[model samples]
Target: MSDLIDDPREGANEPEFTVSEISTAVKRTIEGTFDHVRIRGEVGRVVHARSGHLYFDIKDDRSVLGCTAWKGQVARLSVMPEEGMEIIATGRLTTFPNQSKYQMNVQDVAVAGEGALMAMLEKRKKKLAAEGLFDPARKQQIPFLPEVIGVITSPTGAVIRDILHRLRDRFPRKVLIWPVAVQGERCAPEVTRAIDGFNAFTAGGALPRPDLIIVARGGGSIEDLWGFNEESVARAAAASGIPLISAVGHETDTTLIDFASDLRAPTPTAAAELAVPVRAELLARLEEIESRRISAMRTALNYRGEKLRDLSRALPRVDALTAGAQQRLDLAAARLPGALTARVDRGRAALSEASGALRPSLLARTINSARERSEDRGKRLAPALERSSAAAQGDLARITKRFDTLSLAPQIDRRNDALAQLMRRFKQATEVAHSQRARKLDALDRLRLTLGYKATLERGFAVVRSAKGEVLTSTKLAKAHAVLDIEFADGTLSIGAKKTARPSASVSKKGTQGSLF
Candidate 1:
């Protein structure tokens, strides 16, 4: 057995170990070799976990190295790692015995160089451009004079002081400062949140909403000004309800936020100048306008006064125009009595001539001659009257006999038949009118059913109403915390209204379509 076992030293050279033991040995070797390192590579899939740990992969053309930045170390990183960004990560290598894996525990990270920074920026720019956030139509017009201007920057930095001083020189306005980190890992998130916070205020609340926003920073390199190029900052700026002014770096330093903003300023001071008009210039303009207005009014008054004088000279005197009519009236009054006397004398002469022709003695002689002739005629007519009376009695007796021969029963029967036929026709017309009225009533009933609201309710549609029962047809009218009742065909649902957010251009279009439905 001793010979078969061989030398213990020989056996020790070829060691037999359990899985854990082998893993531990390998971990020590790797960790000891790479105790501290500074590696440069392009970042791959970066995952920020809820536990505040960041896990990512750093890869060159040949191979990839797994990396991790713990919560504390991640907070200290100068540059937040993004996928496809080439960065230099400085940390110590470590191993996980459980999974038999080794990784770099990144303690610090920085952009590899200006070329990498520019590459990353160009990639982000393309993504935002595809979303149309940089469209000219989406940009807002900055107010000439904002009531409350919100400024986002590092409060202690010279940038803020410059902006404030410039604004003071131009026009004094109410400024609300939102202090944020101007660079480093905290910059992007802080800037994004500040923009959202400013927009979240109620328009007329105790803390009034800003009418315009200015995001300013002093001149710096691309890396120092990387926060403005962040996607979150760009989207936030694009989604701002208030018009935004981006002044990130010097005139040549353009960032993603500049495209999304309503206006871009070369410098922080220039941004302030754009926010308001110069006080002296505005006052001078108003004074000029007032002088012009007064001059115009004076000219108008002079023209009107001259016109009134010309009109008065052109008008004829009322008394002079009526003199001829007054004279004619006086002449007619002078001839009135003589004209009446001549007309009365003519009437009296005509009556005297008629009276002479009808004298009483001449009328009495004519009446005596006519009476004698009438008495002779009456004596001759009495004999003829007695002869005619006998013939008339005979004719009357013949006519009475003919009337008795004719029967009246047949005529009475014919009249009764005609009356029955007329009654039957009248009854038919009454029945026809009743049928027509009934048909019209039925048609009217069908029309009423078709036009009723019940028909519309049967369709798959609902009406949303507020607690006060007012219909909510617009998202703007839906207030936070208000109870909304959705009335369906079968039932109704009541829910609390959700707080509305600033919608992007695409989201706004979708919302408009939904409201129409």
Candidate 2:
């Protein structure tokens, strides 16, 4: 029986084992042999499982290797595996007993080399570009001087220091640092969150929304700055409501963020410079503008004053205008006295003639006697007097016709009165138009001041917001957030400080993760 048990065909020489036992032995052998290996192959057929596990194939020309990355491992991957990409995967080889298959337990994945990385980056770029994420029309114009600036970078990096120093030298501005990982897998996501957070601020928050954003990193290799090349980071940049400046790597180092950003800076320090103008230069410019405005106002006033003086000089004096009328009145008065004297003399002479004619001696003389007397004294004088009496009797009869003519002096006076009425109407119309235009300009200036948001902030009010920048209007909302930001007229203050202030970190931010491989 022992000889039978030791038979080669039965168990001893060939080895006898159950399926589970054999699988275990194989798993151990493979795991031990390929433990902590660095394998390079082209990625193929990637599957992102619903349970946050990853399954994929990596192959050379002839052989294929299956790989698996757990949920935890996925987070550490520098670049997720994509089909046809050449990658260097670090992990251990293992076998599954149930499926009778061998695979790699991948801890991380990286593009095989710079060439492969560049190729992948180029592909991603093309894809994002096709979606119009890089359109210039989608870009916001950078504020000439941002009141608040949000910076995303590593908390501990020299990049932040350089940025701060440069900003201090140029124009000092309020900066809110969103600490993040500037590299590694966390970099892209962290940067994306920082951008979203800045945008989430209440329009009227005490911690006001950033007018500008800067995504900055110091000079580094392409591999070191790979986080900025992420599609998510690029998309976030494109979607930013605030104007964004990208300052990743050195002057020659380019990333997808640079393309999507409103502006691109060569370095982190350069980005600070781009964010604000020189303080002294701005002050000088403002002073010059104020001076110009004052000068222009003074010049206009002087011109108007001189023009008014000229008009006044050209106008006839009140006394001069009345002089002609006064002289005419004087002449009329002088003529009136002389004419009255003449009229009195004529009346007396007429009365004397009538009295003489009515005398008894004259009346007693008949026409024949009067005629004989006239011929004796002066027949011509008597005949002439009789003829003049006969003519006056005829003229009196004729004078009874043709009455009702308007006099010249009264007609001329009416014409002058009508002219005066027209002059008054014209003066009123001109003055009315001038006043309306003046009011319109004044109203426009008033409207500009009234509608400005800065004017409202200056009124001693504050806006309550969470550190994430969401407006917390009530106590309940405030309770949900660990930290709070209060925006004041001058600046922002943080309360219930959950996140301690720290230096910068590598760029990265928040969201429901989709796929890591």
Reference-based lDDT, each prediction: 0.89, 0.87
For residues 446-510, what per-residue lDDT tens digits would candidate 2 score against the true structure? 89888965578789767878888998776567767877888888998887734434433443334
* Deviating ranges (above 4 Å) for candidate 2: 1-15, 294-318, 328-517
Worst 10 residues of 2 by lDDT: 508-517
- Any idea what lDDT model 2 has? 0.87
**lDDT score, residue 485, model 2?**
85
CA-RMSD of model 1: 28.6
RMSD of each: 28.6, 35.5
